[model samples]
Target: MPPRSPAEDRAAADSDTAAAGREQTRQRVIEAAIGLLEREGRDAVTTRAVAVAAGVQAPAIYRLFGDKNGLLEAVAEYGFAAFLAAKHVDPDPQDPVEDLKAGWDLAVEFGLANPALYTLMYSEPGNATSAAFTAGMEILMGRIRRLAAGGWLRVDEQLAATLIHATARGAVLTWLSLPEDERNPALLTALRTAMVTAVTNQQPAVRDAGPAGAARALRAALPEQTTLSSAEQQLLREWLDRLAADG
Candidate 1:
């Protein structure tokens, strides 16, 4: 074989090494970005800092995630996917209302379990599993439709779903804002009960015709003698009333 040129040989080796370096840098950038987001919240996620943390040049971030929005989108997607994976709830399609209640319980469990990730996925800016959130809204509507079909929902199916989602989100956000000590034991339990009462009419949630309607609906949903005692019911009702009064 003819002797290869030294420059050509060096050039080929450099290109191969550059390709490997690119991938390593990309992964490093992604990891650093996620860590920064987790540790400092969304505002701390800046390109320069991410690059420094990743030990790569700032431009590498652009190459990897395209832009700040792109990086945010990636984080939201991965964050939510991870959240859903970590949540081990099995939705029962056959009994969707029960499954939805179970899912809501699981959501609170997941939120309390991983507060940072949960907040990032929901309240955190640009930190959303867009696909999952959208799908969840659809599922909520479908469930509302089911309730309507069964004569459980007495209000607009669509509007009812939106309000319930808002209430659940607001409840969690307010709880997160409270001092840990004040968060109180059984808070989620109370909140869940309130939410169920606010939305359910027949042992499951249903649409409400008015503000007090949800609780009354909830009362009607349960058999005359129900699992919740007067005290527990009163507390949940109070919680629901407070939220309702504020709005």
Candidate 2:
């Protein structure tokens, strides 16, 4: 390949600088939208208001995010990124079940800390398809997978995920809705304990030595099962993973 000329190199550098500037402007807009949403509720996050808050023209918001809904989605994504940044996930923990509880607590705390942002991200149903929401789901699934690997799960992986999300969402929204004097810490504790009971087996499959245990054991040994075709093994592994987690 021919080396780039000085003019070409300068053009590339200028393009890079412009791209970085655009991204920085986008971040400023997102931060302004978030502040508006949290301070004055969702209805106050108009493009005009955001432009004034961000010290940018209204057209710039449209150019960067496409529309008002797009801007709100960006704000939601920013909230998710901020929350995830504060969280610490252990890939390998001594006790997967405790790890699960800690993760749940962290999620609930995030929601409580940023009620407006959490409502914007989660109050609606369609957000499941958003990139940020999907990233969060992937993290939740990893925790569920760890439970499965440890033979502590008591429900199908998908169902377990749903249960965990439902419980946490309910706890956060319900707590937020309560009057200050009526808010009880027991509500959170009860929900967390209930989630644990509902999703995890009392005796881990590793210790129970039963069908669930056998299913879990088989799932763990799946990589060594060379008799099955690759596709067949994958299918079997999925079944075993479900069975191992099933109550």
Candidate 3:
């Protein structure tokens, strides 16, 4: 080996710095892509579209993500990461119930705000790594496991948690499909209460006629979004299937 010149050392440092900067820009592009998908349908998203939304050039997207498929994959990963961060969901050590509630609320809010991104993060066949998805699941499941271990959860920990999540997600999606008038505050309250009851050993009023009836009434009151195309219907069907399979 030989000693490098001062210029070479500076060049090496600059290379590392530039790599870091590129990574940051790449992350930004992915985030922007996710936001675009959330606002519009997934079909509306394209490489040029993502670059324009990300405030980067089309060439820059190719350089960062390699291709449209690659960019979409990155966007999936970005979706999960952003969901976790946006939820401000801290992993609780002491109180599992509180932890679960916090996670659920954040997840619901994210789904309500960005249905496309929410579905893609978990259900869509995208480039999201299995480990990445596992870690995301653990963020919510860790609490349920802890509660089960402590005998805080009434039913089978895994099954109960899955149901609670499914119910919450379905309820939220159903609500989103409705007109503003169809968003019933009473139903929302009941569903929230029922969700809490389902997870925790402590029974709430929502466990009985409250959540179940409210959910039914909410459904009855809602009319289909005529704007939903055949593709969107198929997308929702696949998403529901994925949820069932995951459970």
Candidate 4:
């Protein structure tokens, strides 16, 4: 390869500087929006409001996020990233059921602490496509996989994930809807326990002769098995998934 000319080097440096500046501005705006959402609720998070809070012109918000909806999406993505950071992942827990409980509690706590931001993050179905949201889901799925591997999962892995999400979201929304005098900590505890019972077995189901438990264990382990060809493993996974879902 030929060495770069002085002009080319300068152009590249300028591009890098501009990109860094853009990202810094994006961060500033997102933080401002988050502050507004948490303090004054979602209705207070207008583009004009965020731009002023971020110390940038209103046009900058439009340039970076397109519109109010786009800006809210970025704020929701930030909320997901914050929640994901708070999660404590234990890849190989001594008790997957306890691990599940801890994870669910962390999620509910996050939502309760940031009610407005949490509502904005989850109220729109489209927000689920954000990279941060997807990353959070991947972490949840990993936890579910561990449960399946230990024969603790009682439902399909997908169903387990759905139940976990549904319960936590419901808990947060319900708590937020109630008067301060009516809000019960027992409701949260009951929901968490119910979620655990709905999705997991008290004992490792692998000890049983049932196909569901065996299939779940095998499916969890399949990715590590090299005895089968790629095609064979894929086919086996489909069959095992079907059996696992029967639970």
Q: Count of backbone clashes for each model?
A: 7, 0, 0, 0
| lDDT of model 4 at position 9 | 100
lDDT of each: 0.64, 0.86, 0.66, 0.92
Which portions of model 1 show Cα errors greater than 4 Å?
A: 1-28, 86-95, 123-129, 203-247
Backbone clash pairs in model 1 (N, Cα, C under 3 Å; residues 3+ apart or in different chains), count? 7
Top of the candidates by lDDT: 4
lDDT of 1 by residue, 35-116 (tens): 8877887788899988888887788789888998777676666656555565544333566466557667665665666566
Off by over 4 Å in 3: 1-4, 87-95, 123-132, 203-247
User: What lDDT is obtained when candidate 3 is compared to the true structure?
Assistant: 0.66
Q: Rank by TM-score, descending?
A: 4, 2, 3, 1
Task: Output the worst ten-in-a-row residue range by lDDT, candidate 4.
Answer: 216-225
Rank by lDDT (best first): 4, 2, 3, 1
What would the TM-scores of all predictions be? 0.60, 0.91, 0.66, 0.94
| Model 4 alpha-carbon miss at residue 51, Å | 1.5
Name the candidate, 1 or 2, with the larger lDDT value. Answer: 2
Where does model 4 exceed 4 Å of error? none
- Candidate 4 per-residue C-alpha lDDT over 1-247 given as tens digits, one digit per residue, 9 for 90 to 100: 9999999999999999999999999999999999998899888998888989999999999999999998988889899999989988887888888888999999999999999999999999999998989988998999999998888888888889999999999999999999999999999999999999999988889888678987987898887779999999999999998897787
CA lDDT, candidate 1, residue 58: 85
